[model samples]
Target: MQEILVLYYSHRGSVRALAEMIAQGIDSVPGAAARLRTVPRISAVCEATEPDIPSTGAPYAETQDLEECIGLALGSPTRFGNMAAPMKYFLDNTAGPWLSGALAGKPACVFTSTASQHGGQESTLLSMMTPLLHHGMLLVGLPFSEPDLTRTRSGGSPYGATHWAGKDDNIQLTDEEKRLATALGKRLAETALKLHAR
Candidate 1:
């Protein structure tokens, strides 16, 4: 089976939820499976470290995960119009993969969640894409042809899937948001399959 790594960091569970939805969509493709992984929180204190295995949720991701996946779906919660530090921390350590061009030509998509409707979801998604682009991966985004993109009143975007978690981070994803996230995942898997066939 072809694997698409679903890598993400979630503080309030919003981005994690979106990642799972995307994973489900990826697995819906006959030959594709989702490999769910997460990064541990980074500490500001000097030389602090997280446990090797997380207490809950997905385990920490390794560089090999990026190299082995047929495609990638990266997700993170917004931190001041950017990706959260934990996800960024993980991506920052991939210099070896970058040097080896391990991710070159692989299809990649991004997703994000925000605390409010205007909480920089699109910007966060764009920021996440920067690294994938640097790795020479092909970007896959939701197109206007997806009915939910035109109709969504919540977190769906042409750039990627998103969720508005509200100030308290309590809001549930809208139906439109869910559909768009699934659509994005399926699109990524399909594109990856086509590229791999070549």
Candidate 2:
């Protein structure tokens, strides 16, 4: 099976929910598997560190994960119209992959969760794509062909899948958001398969 990396950092459960749904979609593809990974929270104190294994969630990602995966699904919580600091910090440390062109020509997609309806989901997705582009990865996005792209009043976009978790991060992903996120994953996996085949 070809593995697609579902790498993310979730401050709350919202982004993790979307990542899970996306993983389900990825696994639905015949020869695709989702390798779930997460990063530790960035500490405010320079001396602080997180355990190698997270207490309750996905294992911490290493650059080896990026090199081995056939494709990538990047997710993060929105932070002032940008990706959260932890996700950004992890991406910033990928110099080895960047130097070796490890992710070149790979398929990639992005997702994000935000605290409000206008919490900049699109911007966060775009910001996450910047480094992937530098790595020469091909980007995949939802198109109008997916009915959910038009029907999702909550968190679907042509840019990528998204979720509005409300001001307190209490909202669940709407059905439309779920379908769209799944569709985005399937699309990503299918695209990765075709590219890897070449």
Candidate 3:
């Protein structure tokens, strides 16, 4: 099976919800599977460290996961118009992959959740794409052709998928948001398959 790594850092579960939907879409494609992984929270204290295995949710992602996957779906909650620190921390350490060009030509998509409708979802998605671009990964985004993209009143974007989690972060994803997220995943998987076939 071809694996597409669904890598994310979710704090309030909003991003996690989106990640699950995306994984479902990836799995829907025959011969393509989702490898869900997450990174641990980073501590401000320089000496602090997280456990090797997380207490719940996905396992902490290793560099090997990047090497094994044919495609990538990166997600994170917005932090001041940018990706959360934990996800950024993980990507900051990907110099090894960058040097080896391990992710070159692999298809990638980004997703994000925000506390408000204007909580910088697009900026966060764009921020996350920077590292993937540096790795030479091809970006896949929601196109206007997706009906949900034109209809979504809550969370969806041409840049990628997004969720408006509300200030309390308790709002459920709208139907349109779910459909768009799933479509983005399927698109990434299909793109990866086509590229891999070459």
TM-score, every prediction: 0.97, 0.97, 0.97
In the range 1-198, model 3's lDDT, one tens digit per residue, is: 999999999998988889999999999999999999999999999899888999988999999999999999999999999999999999999999999999999999999999889989999999999999999999999999999888877899999999998877864789999999999999999999999999
The true-versus-predicted C-alpha distance at residue 107 of model 3, in Å, is 0.5
Q: Which residue pairs overlap in candidate 2's backbone?
A: none
Candidate 3 lDDT for residue 176: 95
- Which runs in model 3 stand beyond 4 Å of their true positions? none
What's the best-to-worst order under lDDT?
Answer: 3, 2, 1
Query: Which ten residues in a row are the worst by lDDT in model 1?
Result: 166-175
| Candidate 1 to truth, TM | 0.97
Task: Give the per-residue lDDT of model 2 (tens digit) for 77-163.
Answer: 999999999999999999999999999999999999988889899999999999999999999999999998888777988989999
Q: Against the correct fold, how does model 3 do in TM-score?
A: 0.97
Top candidate, metric lDDT: 3
lDDT of 3: 0.94
Clashing pairs in 1: none
